[model samples]
Target: MVSDPVQQPHVPVLLRPILANVAPVTGTWIDGTFGAGGYTRGLLDAGATRVVGIDQDPLAIEMAQPWAGQYGDRLTIVQDNFANLDTVAGENCPEGVDGIVLDLGVSSMQLDLAERGFSFLRDGPLDMRMSQSGPSAADLVNTLEEGPLADILYLYGEERASRRIARAIARERAVEPITTTLRLAKIIEGCLPRAKPGQSHPATRSFQALRIAVNDEYGALAEGLMAAERALKPGGILAVVSFHSIEDRMVKRFFQLRAGGTGNANRYAPQLEEESPAFTQKTRKGIGPDDEELEINPRSRSARLRIGYRTDAPADDIDRAALGMPGAGDRKGRKG
Candidate 1:
């Protein structure tokens, strides 16, 4: 049986910086990626009047029920993706939210549960669906063409030997379907060299690539950022904690463009008209975990936090290309 995510111990990453930057949290807030209820609880404890916790995973909502009642009406749980946060907030809060917090990527709870199939360390079915629906990692591994599979590994995971690993997967799956975590890990391991001390596992990149593809994480993130802009009230705080370089890059660029910081980096490019900035950047650069957080949770090493405050200007459409979102064409094995 799957365990309760809320009951499980999870330290919210960059909680200190988030709270400090978005200080005096008084109005209703929305925890967009309400995994394990860590950020929601933290916000409530930090003096928020109310918090709407949103999660795509049913398990998170189910787990939250046992503890959510303690706050009575102050805490509301919604079953939906953050990409639809604006709609969810309108239906639940209606007045618009004063703050929004998004902690991106898979949660520690999902990774710890073997049956959830997010981790390669413990063997389980190769299912990496965040919403617990749609095509699973097993399906992608067993069915996708070698070229596409290679593309996912290369573009999503930044694996240098993606072609080699993809060839190995194709060769193995033809004999029998790759259906389990250990089975897939073993295949990837065979393609890569043994890891040195302190190095990540051989299957790390392949597993990450498969998980991102299975969940359409990048697509969700791009849409969710825009959704947050629409959902937040003027002067509202938007705090986002991202893990890994790809995620950080997207968040950084999103804030930059929304704050009217974007322009042609090339000196020869023609000057462009400036639009009203939507948000004011709170942090000039991404904030990483402090030493105390690092000591408490080593996984926070790759974490980065970026924050912005919504301006009175109306929300504007963002050029997805400007946000550094990896193109779908990249997944189709197209060379730019």
Candidate 2:
């Protein structure tokens, strides 16, 4: 993997916009997915007296520790998934944070390290665990039944050829267990019809699906959102930069429900509002990276950021059924 930046890479996608929206300068803050501590550094530079950095990847935590020392008690890094942000933050910053920032999806460092098995473009092990301990992609593809396998590809990858791919996987794994990234990528590609000249690689979607399933990315996102809600004080800001449709939709719904408040769909029925809405929408619409940033960081192209301010209400259970988002049970394995 690339060493710590000689300079910042592409300005940490939507940094300026998030700074403007969240205004994280003079209080405790949380950089929930502290990939390389870019956002945390920015927050501290903005005058935040204390910032807690949380990440599932131990490597990220290691990298962030030095920054904590440099910041001299103003910064601390925790090794854990952002889903546990509430507990972690309460322990680290009992006062609660003024702002929380989450930059979702695979980090550049993770994808850049071929040995980590995160990107199909760089063949490595079939493992895709962000924490490097949970089920690997190989484990899922070789062990899951065809039906559930198909569901994972369909739901997480959003691939249309889910059934065909899953069937091919089952057939191949019956002969031998899928073991490596390249092997699985090849199996996914072989299951597809020949691509047209301008079409994308057939394995793209299936690989993505397996990675998401292996890491439970969406599940973590949902839990992290709820945790952030619990960790923030009233008027505290929450900012998220999502990379895909699934994540973007989840964040959109979460912000809308918390900020807009609950109400009855039927006009004839009596409507009830909580003592206080959980949050207020800070950004009327999700913001994207500017053209200049996109030009330098292609990965920033897919990022969509939404910001919200916590309201004076207690945190509530996330309505997974209503949100159409995955649950922890769903993240443990394949789901079509």
Candidate 3:
């Protein structure tokens, strides 16, 4: 049986910065990721009149049953991806929302459960589907071609040993299906050097790549940013917290592009037309965990928070390439 996530306490990362930057949080707010109900609860406590919590994982919605009723009508929980947050907002907050909070990447609650297979340390089934349906990590490891698999590890995870790892996976899977977390982790460990003190696990990159592929996380994030633009009222706030460099890059590029900062870095290059800024940011460099947060939650070291306030400018179409998504401009993507 799977262990209950509630058994392990979850500490929301950068919650203080989000509340501070988007101060006096009011009106309807949407917690796009809604993992562990941390942001949702925080928003409500911080003065939001109403909060909509959205999550792709059914287990998340199911697990909230015990505490969800405490908020009464002030909190609404929905089962869906944040990419469709605008659609969900249309039905819930037709007038648009005052704020939206997105905590990207896998949640700690999900990682703690051995059955979720998000962590190699736990040694669970090789299933890493955030939505708990469709293709899983095992499916890709077993069936995907070495080239595509390598692309996923290299591009998505930024794993330099991608080719070597893929070759090992291919060889090991041929002998027997890579059906468990430890078995696949062993394969990746064989390819990469053992970690030094305080370094991440050898299988970290491979697991991250597989999870992203299985959940279509990058595609969802690209769409979700656009949806937030359309769904926010003028002066509304959108706060995003991202983990890892790839996710931070995408968020940084999205904020820069939407704020009309997208331009040729070359001083001599011809200037491209800039769109009317849809959002404005106070922190151009983004915010990270302070010393206090670091002392309390060591996992937050990689987390970065970016804030954007919506303007009255009309929502516009954004090319996926503009956001620096892994498989975007190069047109090289991983697929089964």
Which predicted model would earn the best lDDT?
3
Ranking by lDDT: 3, 1, 2
Q: Candidates ranked by TM-score, best first?
A: 3, 1, 2
Spell out the clash pairs found in candidate 2.
151-335, 151-336, 152-335, 152-336
Cα lDDT for residue 235, candidate 2:
83
RMSD of 3: 3.2
Q: Which sections of candidate 3 miss by over 4 Å? A: 264-272, 328-336
lDDT of 2: 0.79
Per-residue lDDT over 244-291 for candidate 2, one digit per residue giving the tens place of the 0 to 100 score: 888888888777677764643224334445445798884568898888
What TM-score does each of the candidates earn? 0.94, 0.88, 0.94
Model 3, residue 242: C-alpha shift (Å): 0.3
Q: What's model 3's TM-score?
A: 0.94
lDDT of 3 by residue, 111-131 (tens): 988899899988789999999
Q: Pairs clashing in candidate 3?
A: none
